[model samples]
Target: MRITRIETFLVPPRWLFVRIETDNGIVGWGEPVVEGRSETVRTAVEQLAELLLGKDPLRIEDHWQVMTKGSFYRGGPILASAVSGLDQALWDIAGKHLGVPVHQLLGGHVRDRIRMYGWVGGDEPAEIADSICAQLDVGLTAVKMNASGRMHPIGSVGEIDGVVERVAAARDVLGPHRDVAVDFHGRFTLANARRVAPLLEPLRPFFIEEPVVPENSHLIGQLTRSTSIPVATGERLYSRQEFLPVLQAGIAVAQPDLSHAGGITEVRKIASLAEIFDVQLAPHCPLGPLALAACLQVGFATPNYLIQEQSIGIHYNQGAEVLDYVLDKTPLKFVNGHIERLTGPGLGIEIDEQAVRSADKNGHAWRSPLWRHDDGSYAEW
Candidate 1:
């Protein structure tokens, strides 16, 4: 069947969803957002759709290469994210046509279910112990939180002590068995990363995310040598070529987002490349249902897969949540901190098209916050 229509929706809580329609009446859903820049990605998808109309819906790889490389200049958050959403929809269509889940198309599942983790304590840390305890009470085995609210290029020891205290509180609540990861959120500098890294070492975190930024690969090697904790990054990275240095640098985990990092087609390759270096896969997904579903499909197929990051009750979602626009949330059923393998065809979860159409009318224009320090200088938020 041929692709007939491409539609996009900018919904609440800073999300953009894409739907691909085919002549045979089978449709597929995808999330191709760049967090705050939903509208820009939407326009990118619309422009790409001009070339995609009347093409074979099942030619996912060809379409992927064309949609991405078909342009002379390509691969960044906006263009790649637009291509990412389209790639997801193409895979979803192909899976439905074959009467199997996307994982099956990727060579089937290696395990039963993939463990998932959720965010707590918002962007900063406060009442985090209660949040940890609440998730633990719900039978979640893993949770991740931000390490600090904001910071300077060189932070004070008192600031480091505050982070240590927060982690200590989480460790106390988590006891010794559960896994806890901290996202530095690229707020820490190499100097600060070194200082904070060793302090959190005794707590034995599951990992420390973006100890610095991906731009600081050399510094990552430096920090990892100083600390025993596993170093995880790559949420902002867009390609396998970009990830080679991260893997070669001895990064413990690769956290590529299926939605942002070229969707299923490219992330599977990224997972394979990471596996060769003995790096684990812990997809970074803090968006909506389609993005989470896409990550799950990859998680099931990748052998070195670790826990998946989800945004079920994340601080980013103010009004609309993951289960908001879906018809059946059962496919995403989280139990005992893990979501079972999706059995349904395509991305496994069906969207409420009517709900989507309605939400599209409300059509949001969401952007992330821009933070600044007391000196009126910019600080990562």
Candidate 2:
């Protein structure tokens, strides 16, 4: 069957969903968004649709190669994210056509269930304990929290102490059996990260995510070597090529977002490359249902897969949630901190087209928060 129509929806709480239709009536859905820049990515998706219409829906690899390199200028968040959603849709179609799950087509299950982690707002140390406890109540054994909010460029002793205090709070709540991952969120300099990572060592965090932003990746090896904490990054990174240097920098975990890093097609390759380095795949997905579904497909087939990030009750969701647009939440239900392998074809979870269409009419314009230091200088948020 040939692809007949490609439609994009600008949904609430900052998500862009793409729906691909084929002549024979099978439809596949994907989340192709760059979070705050969903509109720009939506335009990119519409432009990419030009190449997909009237083509064979099953020519995934060929379409991927062409969509990525078809343009004179290539490879950025918008283009890669655009290709990412379309790629997911193609894979979904292929899986449905073959009457198997996407992971089965990828090779098959490496494990029966996938471990998942939820987000806890750690910007304020006082709220961390309660937030983590809430996640625990919902059966999540692990949770990720931001290490700091607006950190000083060269963190003061107080700022450093606050970071330790926040993690200590999470550790106190988690106890020894549960896990806590600290997200540096690229808010720290190399020196700041180096200074603080060792302090968190005693708490034994599952990992310190994005210790330094993607731009300063060259310096990550320094931070990784100086501290015993496992370093994880790649949410901002968009391809295997972009991830190679960071992987070479000795990160212990690769957190590529399936929605941003060329979807399942390229992230699977990134996981393979990271495997050679003995790194684990903890896909960075704090988005919507389709993105989480796509990540799960990859996690099931990948041997080195560690944990999955899902945005069920994340603070980012203002007017909508992960389960809001899905018809059946059974495939996404958490059982003792893990989601059982999805058995349905394609992405496994069926999306609510009516809900999605209704939400699009009142689309959101979400932007990342901008921060400034006490002295009025720009700061990472």
Judging by lDDT against the true structure, name the best candidate.
2
CA lDDT, candidate 2, residue 247:
88
lDDT of 1 at 250: 87
Give each model's whole-structure lDDT. Answer: 0.88, 0.94
Stretches of candidate 1 exceeding 4 Å from the true structure: 122-126
TM-scores across all candidates?
Answer: 0.98, 0.99
**Tens-place lDDT digits, model 2, residues 1-381:** 999999999998999999999999999999899988999999999999999999998989999999999989999999999999999999999999998999999999999999899999887766998999899999999999999999988999999999999999999999999999999999999989989988999999999999888899999999888988899999999999999998898999999999999998999999999999999999999899999999999999999999999999999999999999999999999999999999999999999999999999999999999999999999998
Per-residue lDDT tens digits for candidate 1, residues 1-381, read: 898999998888888999999999999999999988888899999999997899998888888889889978888889888888899999999999989999999998998998988777733344887798778776689999888888888998788888888888888888898988999999999999998988898999999999887677767888877888999999989989889988998899999888889999999999999999999999999989999999999888889999999888877888788998888888898788899999999999988888877888887767778899889999987
Q: Model 1 residue 368 lDDT?
A: 72
Candidate 1 lands at a TM-score of 0.98
